[model samples]
Target: MTTTSGNTNPASVQLSAQAFRDVIGRFASGVTVITTCSGGRNFGTTASAVTSLTDDPPMLLICLNKSSTSAHAIRESGTFAVNVLAEDHVQLAGRFASKLPDKFEGMAFEKDGNGSPLLVGAIAHLVCSVSEQVEAGTHYVFLARVEDAVAYPGHPLAYFRGAFGRMQMAPDASVLREVRERIITTVNEVDQAIDLDRWAAELAVGVDLVHRALIALVSEGLVRREAGQFVIAPVPESIIFESYTAKLAIELGVAESTVGRVSQGQLTQLRQYMEATFEFIKDDRFTDPEAWIQANERFHEYMVELAGSKILLDTYRRLGLPGLNARTINRSTYATAELLNDHRKLVEAYENKDLGAVVEVLREHADRPRQLRARERELFGRA
Candidate 1:
């Protein structure tokens, strides 16, 4: 690589070691633990510098730091196993990466045909025999023929920008939902920094995913990142009031399109869902915020759902109005009469084909959350 700056004569700009590493680290790759047995002693080291060269002859290549003892062990043994790690094998990857004197101590593993440790729980294991070696600057490149390969059904662990993570074979949004659910049901005892690794293990996901979720939460006002650590933030009134106002905007537009157009059948569904919200606030259900939240969501969702676009309805749900209720509305003292009263007026307006009244009712309905939030603020002094 070469560089020229500010129209100067093209002079050689030697890439600094940090610059070289920073540029190369952007190319994400699956992590592997290379294992070999030299003189009847097991040796292993974590590697991301591996690739499939070709399948015509089952060839692959791996680059190892020339000074690595594991590389020397593979040279003496003439054979090695590439243990492609699974997303959950984070600790195992760390164990082999460290200079712990014995990476396989007190661990159970199966040996491949060539006597290399087939790390248990790896997503795949490829036993290979070194066929050729090439000297690369500061590293040794081994061209190998795979003697045996076994792949399991699992996601591969990934390395990128000097950090461990997981590769996505397909787009996944479950991590966002899982992290939100975790925060909703969980109560933090101490206001301390988040333990990203602990969250990953609990959620059975990569720490990278947990880290992404926490970073996103910072913008949502549900978490705060201070000095490289995360702490849960008090749920902000802005997200709450803004969410309800957003729903009102969508609902008002929906009301303009679907006032008298709503069929009797859809009206009945609206009534059923709306009335169910009252059911949850009844004596046996007053404490069940979850049930009330579901009923409330279905009631409002049906209104916009009448707009007849799955995409629009999906967009509405993504605003996550029910989720706001989940985060708030902690005690049974939550007064629903006023909110449900607005629902009744909304239904009456829709039945009568009164668009003006429908719009008026929605604007008023959205203020219910602000009222509740104000009451909450007065109770807790949360600013």
Candidate 2:
């Protein structure tokens, strides 16, 4: 049989038609009603090929068979809307799927604030004005701008090949248990004969266990690993990705987590680490900024680790110490003195065990750098 990864040739997989359907049905997709209007006529089609591409000025894409009548209308009109279907709209979905004479004969819908027509009970609707179109094989893919949108509280209708489906959230306890099990499995799966470096040594677990655990963690939507380490997935990159607010938020989070946890001994170790870091930067002796950057990251790691949330710590590690971006440090623009001052505030916050104040300071600590860098960037014209 052909594996899911498509590693084996399709011809090698021998299966009856029914069996083929069963196997191909494993992949899941969100059901959507794609709508387009042109020449004063509106048309709708059921599709599963809609997906979001970005949030900044929000964008989404929908692919359609070029031969589909609706595809021609969308191309002519230069606009369309992807209405994410609700579970109860299976009949509506079917109606759109067919090339019936008048699919919207009895359908109830209203023109949205944008010119797009919206199905009344859709879970979510994205009214898009086409930005670009690309032809891929027989499909004309339209990337569009989210001009407007609306949503109603309902379960999303999902599809896997031929059948409809829905997403169900697992209980937290069960999820945690599953994650632990996967981690255990990964720790044991790594081949011992393969001499792993120090970083890999920290991952002393079975290969499958590690793989499954990471997958589970990612799938759970609680954590994310941006590069080498893991950290909390940001709620919205709208503020984080393109703004200075993002950097500050990251720092504040790390600081708060660090200050909220750890013993006096741990604090002392942290203090020593910070002082050593400050001294190294002051000496101007280190030629390789990466080494300094690593040490700088380790200091923050101590704080994040002390926060006692493995998930948070993992996320911080993943974000790779936002304050130490290579460009920021390499250009000699890093605020080492400011960081040391922040460290003192973090130590005080830790000693006082004031969670509220810790969070407050952390937030400010994070925002300050981002705000300044933004201004700097504005002045310097994209540094």
Which model scores highest in lDDT? 1
Question: 308, model 1: CA deviation in Å?
Answer: 6.1
State the C-alpha lDDT per candidate: 0.82, 0.66
Candidate 1 global TM-score = 0.54
TM per prediction: 0.54, 0.42
lDDT of 2 by residue, 1-383 (tens): 45544447776666666766678677788899898777888888899888889999799888999878999999898888888998877889889999997887878888755456788889988888989999999899999999887887888988987888776544354334544333322322322222223313455544444444444555644346555554434223232333345434655666555554567898788777676566444422334456666776677677766656788765555443433244244434434355556666766766787767767766666665566557556765655
| Candidate 1 residue lDDT tens string, 223-334 | 7888899886655768778878888889988998899998999988888887877766653224577777788888999899999989889878777777667766654544
Error of 2 at 285 (Å): 83
Give the worst 10-residue stretch by lDDT in candidate 2. 187-196
